[model samples]
Target chain A: MTPNTTTADPLRKAASGIAGLDEITFGGLPAGRPTLIAGAAGCGKTLFALTFLVKGATAYDEPGVFMSFEERADDLIDNVSSLGYDLPGLIADKKLVIDYVRVERSEIEQSGEYDLEGLFVRLGHAIDKIGAKRVVLDTLEALFSGLGDGPVLRSELRRLFQWLKDRGVTAVITAERGPEGQLTRHGLEEYVSDCVIALDNRVDEQITTRRLRVMKYRGSAHGTNEYPFLIDKGGISVLPVTSAGLSHSISDEVVSSGVAGIDAMLGVGGFYRGSSVLLSGPSGTGKTTFGSHFVNAACLAGNRAIYFSFEESPEQIVRNMRSVGLNLDSHVTAGLLRFESSRPSLFGLEMHLVLMIRQIDQFDPAVVVIDPISAFRGSESEIHATLLRLVDYLKVKGITVVFNNLVNGDQDDRNEQSLSSLMDVWVGLHDLEANGERNRGLFVLKARGMSHSNQIREYRLGSDGVTLIEPYIGPHGVLTGSARIVQEAQEEAATLERRDEVNRRKREFTEKKSAAERQIAETREALQREEAELLALETVDERKEQILTASRSAAATRRGATA
Target chain B: MTSPTTPDPMGEDGAEISDDGIFHFRLYVAGQTPKSLAAIRNLTLLCDAHLPGRHKIEVLDLAENPELAAQDQIIAIPTLVRSLPPPLKRMIGTLSDPDKFLIGLDYSRPTS
Candidate 1:
């Protein structure tokens, strides 16, 4: 008996057409089958269903039937108009149908053995009228509450699901999130469907983020993590960051760090074209300045760049950077550089990531700068997770990313340390003080695969941009700021004092030599004069000795006395 | 009120099974599944015991005519619709339990 292998499961998929959603699901919802999208209030359950139907009818050329159990047709259309979906027009053109089924438990009477044949007849007729391939039973559980709980209702729902499947129509049935781990308010809905997508709106630190997770997909593989989704003017956009693995291509070409000295510090005269750089520093350590330089350098090279500022507004960034000679206005005018500055508290980290990723893709920047990644105030693990995803995504795309992180104390900042390895080059900028003045010190913490310089350059944030001072060193450590000037002056003065002392000692020795020469000449003259007088006395003594010629013995005695 | 009505009295074999003197039972099914065949067989046996050729059993397959499912207000498969009775009674499911079935149609069996 050969086991049947002809598509035994026969899995088919339908693209939901929601951005990043299909990628996470590996495809869309199961085709020609019912998929349950469950969530709590205001979690975009209704909008998601509407978007699916609208996108289906518009993009896939497959007409759809929207059987709403909660909202009226007009309200649905009006509420979804902001997303630019023309439901009424689609309905008029026979591309879509909207049927609002309102059930009142108080006004209805259920005789014995009565099933929901009316709903089936209506749904069936609607499906047949348009030959629809897509169907949405929004808030399908509303009927359960209206009809009361019974086996008849449950069995009828099962029949309805099977009937839809048998008719070969892919359907989306939405329900309220049930208690605990239930996918739907009524547990039976998920069992009858082929796929179940759960939406959750979580608020932490007063910032809310909508996340989507595929609880179960019967046939196909899917992302298990709860991917964060955004509901803006356009609609829901899921950020499948982690699902998009690190399979993106790499680049070995070198690019400048915008500052020449900093580029010199890194190997290859700059950073790799797509490598990630972390410019970490304390507050006001010119992290933003370095970011501006990168943007400027990228734009000057005729490549696009996007700067996400979590601490300042766009105008404020432009205005602040103007003082540093980084004229970003022209780049903004030329559309080569984009500045997206938003307060970190405005949204959750994931939403910011969605916005950033969306902007990055739309702009297709060659370089991306996120100033102060420290703005995320989630749990340590959460921040790490976000940054990890951000780095991984940018790296895979071969888009160079520079994240400016601020570290407070000398202690190892876990947040910065956690993301250090993902960085291809980590440049730590510091606020160093030695002699009553603050200075900026920069060092390459690590540069992967590059023979980067190990010297710490004292950088200057001047009116014309970042410049690295010479590696001036002294006994007081690396000299910088006023300390450098003061030490140089002190050294110069000490050298001059040493020269003056040597010159004074030479002058005193010359004066003493002339006086000693004068003294020796005087003594020689005096000795000569005395020896002449003694010669005269010796002559007189010779005359006296001649007078006493007879006295030879006396001369000998005189000689002996002289001796 | 005791006499059953004879409306479109057609049986599975194109013979008139009811002529106002017979109880009419329309057993709706979705083709030849085991459950549908079992329902037809059980209904025929019950009718043979109770009415002794005084009842007409008409079997309708929804698979052949899905549109007819709407006409008979049929939702669940393998239903028994007693159309001829003054007060129309509909019993859904495979009718595996004869006691539940008889009681569902407002009938009492002779002492259990």
Candidate 2:
């Protein structure tokens, strides 16, 4: 039985302090068992080994022993120092021991009685002296060359593996890869270790990308994809691709799209808070216009906002929006809105991502706008992968995001659709000409949880801001730039003859009434002279009534006798 | 100097106390344990010899300062480090060979 065999469960596993690699390997590398890291030169083999030992010594409190078969101890320390690790200082602390074993097969002969017993003895002595729990054998390829024969080297390798296991110290044995089918020399050392990891430095279509994959891990489950990784000043960072497809439940708080009419088109008149929206259009097609409206509206609604601009600076954006009557100066002073503008080529893609993450984490803006994500295509090496990573990072933090994409004049592809597919909502804008002029048009392609108006509404930008008009060309044709439909309706109302005829008749009637008023005034003057004649006629009528009354009185006596 | 200086109790051959503010000192031992004790003794004598008034000497058993041993990057025991007076220097192996120590530290006799 091995010295640490009684535990059955190894308590001294070397925790690879990488972000997602540990989750893939269950806990970490098997404790006190040799693990082989096979890769080509410049594929991060040395870095992986050094990071393992340094991170173990610094982070996990596990003292380490590094035996370099290639580089001097000083060179290794200098190389890893740029990654923010203090290797020289740790060496000074005695918790970590580094030994350089230089092997030149040409100078030293390998006979039938060759063995690595002396090397093992030094390693064991160092480990005991410092009580090291982790060991790194930088490259075993040099040792294999010294052995000369494959069978003999293989036996020696097997013996060395048993020795490390018996000592109960987790070891990392690194080797350079061979041509094609095998990762390391003859694949002998990999088969002996409990875990095998292969790193690749590949150039595809003239674009160089580094990928890491777990080829095999005995009695364990691990991620199988070749994950993209970045080597920066802070050491190597791997972008775990598996979490890209993970699902999350969306929040239910209502958030404004900055325009009341635009929100009215949505059934709830708003979007779920923390949901991502995509505003897609062509150049000068009001993508930034829409985003500005959202930012201004968010500011007015008491929500802090951040706008990331690639096409224009904050001052330029403010000046342009001023022409459309959006006053952002007060909001800028109020500290409710922050506009960050930069040329995309100013930094590498990951640096931009890290900067954005850092800024958002510090500012903690409620709303974030990336004006025209397509600009990232020119700035990033891999557009879709980088955007997906950024989106994942934002979504994990539950930030409300708005992405503007420029779809160049009618040229659409799977990548555009993929970006649009990532959004919780998609708003498409276009310029259509109908009748005889060009008019602006808007449509909502999709809103995941809310029902929206499916009709293409016409809109006009005036002093009062964007106004949605009834579709003059009705639901079918292009409203193109001139707004000919509106001009046609105006011209149709102008060409009515009945209205002109009615106005003419009303004018003639008013003239006749004025003429009658003049005639009546003349008749009133003549009536002053006719008043005496009329009074004489009234006296004659009164006498006739008196005579008729006298006759009736005489006839009444006769009628009484006849009755 | 006005005050009469004390003689080094742990001094061996080739160790000399100078008049112009320089102290030459040596320690003797056999193995790791004795060497550690000798290093501590020799550091104390030198600290007292050169920095008479305001100085403190610390003795670290290598077995105890095992970490300190690694920190100083000590491969052999009974190492003496001249920490003060600028350009800190160290000598190992119980400092038994005083000529080598003085020459290694550039404090040998004046040729005048």
Top DockQ model: 1
What is the per-residue lDDT of model 1 for residues B7-103, given as tens digits with 9 covering 90 to 100? 2222223232234546678887776877777778777776766556567788987666666654555545566777654346666656666555554
**Fnat by candidate, in order:** 0.06, 0.00
User: Model 1 misses residue A375 by how many Å?
Assistant: 0.8
* Candidate 1 ranges beyond 4 A from true positions: A1-9, A243-248, A409-411, A493-563, B1-112
Q: Indicate the docking level reached by candidate 2.
A: incorrect
TM values, all candidates: 0.73, 0.64
TM-score of chain A of each: 0.85, 0.74
- Model 2 lDDT per residue over A1-563, tens place: 35657137644456887655676676778777888888888988888888888888888888899988888888998888889989878888877888877655533322112234345555766788778989988887787665465665677677778888888888888888888787787665544557888888876444456677888777677788776566667686665644455465568777888777789999888877777888887776678877888888888988788889988999999988887778877788999888888877655454455556656766788888998787763323366666776777667667778899887655674567777657888888766644555556788899989999987877667665666776555344534445554556665777666688788999998899999998999899789669978999999999999999999999989989987
For each candidate, give the interface RMSD after superposing the true interface residues on Cα. 6.5, 13.3
lDDT of candidates 1 onward, in order: 0.81, 0.69
The deviation in Å at residue A401 for candidate 1 is 1.1
Expressed as tens digits, the lDDT of each residue in A303-410 for candidate 1 is 999999998888988999999999999999999999898889888988998999999889999999998898877888888788778888887778898999988946
Each model's DockQ? Answer: 0.07, 0.02
